[model samples]
Target: MAGDPPTTPSSTQTGVPNNGNNPSPSEDPNNGNSPSSTDFASLPSATATGDINSTDKGLDGGAVAGVAVGCLIAGLIIGAIVMWLVFRAKGSRYTRRRRRSEDRGRLMHSTRDANLVALESSRKPMKLENFILQPAPDKEIISDLSRLDDIIRQHVETVYHFEPVDVKVTALAHSLTAIGYSERLSGLQVEDVATWCLQTETRCGALRHVLSHVLFSSIDWNSPGALTLLPQPAIGFLNSIRPIGEYRNNFDVMSFAWTRWRTLSALFLHPSPQERTPLEVSEDDIQGQVETLAKALDPVLRYFVAPDEESQHQQHDHLRVMIMETAKLGYTLFSHTSDWKFIYRDDSGKRCPVLCIGLEKLCGSDGYRLVSPQRIVEPRVMS
Candidate 1:
């Protein structure tokens, strides 16, 4: 090769350009046909890759955090709802229990109120008996006596005077004489006479008052004094009037009296000794005696006494024996008076026999023995 071209150094040996001062095509900066030093495939593009990875990581983290927070919020809501439901259920149960307890308490109170004790069986029976024997207040006695006088006056004017003026005068004189003679024979003071008159009038007035209001207008024709006449809410009230054993008898007595006295006046209707024939004098006297005996007995007997030998005869004998004994003592029997403590006293001290009986049956010794009205407790029901 040296002989052929006395040659210059090859480019590979000197690591320089074959042409002096000229760069090879691969190393020339201006060379368009040669490879450049920048290798896009081998050198990593760290800036762009790092930026993209950081952004993706940030997005993923945000998504995870959002999911966690959302789950936590959902769980909290569910827990709150469950707790609310549990508390509500507990509250409802507690309310039910409270209501049941209240109802039981009310029922017990009502039962206690309805159970009555007999006055005769009380611990202080003797005291109660003495109290019962005491006469009613003077104000009430005077009012009742005045009323009886008015009724007698009306009867004389309306019925006795219808026949003849002379008969009317005779009838008036006989009535006055009978009352006056009875008072004198009994050796009664003016107050005592007035009291006796009041007792008689009150006994008769009670029946008349009941008949005037209940029998004439309020009675059911098919079933007199039936409980159906009361309101539905008052069924319990009706049951509270008498004990289970005595309700029927008492109710029947009331009904019978109401009906019987509806057509009759409360005043006594009898023939005077002057009006009677000589043959009828003994019978008239006996009848007057019987009338006085009947008035002395318990007023309840007038309605409840049976006509059989077991009741009416025995009652009659007892009254007859009592009258005879009273006569033997020289204490005239006709003008005698007895106190009826079975009657109730209102705020004004007026006697209300029916109300007294009702209260005695309903409230027992608690109300009957006390001077005040009984207090009752009512039940509370949940809506």
Candidate 2:
């Protein structure tokens, strides 16, 4: 300690002299670099703001890191929501398609059931209005009428035999002469074939006998032979003609009914002979049809009798009864046509017969037509 020199800072700080012969000052051990008694203190307290600037810079770095992390998490959340919505839309579309498929299946099954019932009803010919149609959903059940016409034609051919044609044609001529029947032909009054045959008075063959009863001549009919045969036959023949209903509107049926329409029509144009009879037809053939239908229906209709009062107004309604009754016993209206003659016993026990024939004058553009039980009434023309 005695050899140690005095610290240099004491001299410089204190500006004290180190008298070589004098002793060291810490010699007193009282001072370090704490301060010199005569010097002022140097201090960093004036620049304390630099520490604040460094702290603010560190806080800004932490805030930026926090914002970047929050943005990344928010983006992940939005992305999840968008994916969920897309999946939801796909699921909804699937459900809608499945529901539609089920509905179509149900509709198909119901349609099949309705179709079956309609088809069965048509086969039985049930009341057309009541049957619900699924397949052929036509407004009118009667729209397809060709089938009905075919059925009626088949029935006619089945019933009428052809053998009676000649007898009917022969009988028609006799009744014509007995009655004064005339036709206006070529604008000149030409007597009909029937009239021509009967009044001829010339002792001649069968065909020529019809010719003499031409124009308007008195036919002296005898009580026996040809004249005698004309009466009941006349009634039968007259009953054969009937009024048919117009199921379809033909331009001709559309034309109002006028008297002796065909004869008047002939005046406008020289009608083809085919117009008088059907094409591919001879007088012999159509006359055959008349006799065939007449003979066949006579027995068939006669055999089908009416029910008693016990079952009065049963299955056959009054409408049907009137129609059928007229068909069977309604002879009072039947004595006018030329096909047969009518004979009746007036209470005098004598057979006084009146003669009538089919008036070519009354038949319309169509020739004589017959009505059957099941036939629909439409004015039937030769065509």
Q: How much is 323 displaced in model 2, in angstroms?
A: 4.2
Tens digit of per-residue lDDT, candidate 2, span 302-339: 21223354333331232232222222211211111111
lDDT of 2 at 125: 40
TM-score of predicted structure 2? 0.23
Weakest 10 consecutive residues of candidate 1 by summed lDDT: 330-339
lDDT of each: 0.35, 0.32
Off by over 4 Å in 1: 1-44, 59-77, 80-82, 85-104, 107-111, 114-383
lDDT of 1 by residue, 264-344 (tens): 111112133223211111233344543553453334233324446666666556544433322221111011122112111
Whole-model alpha-carbon lDDT for candidate 2: 0.32
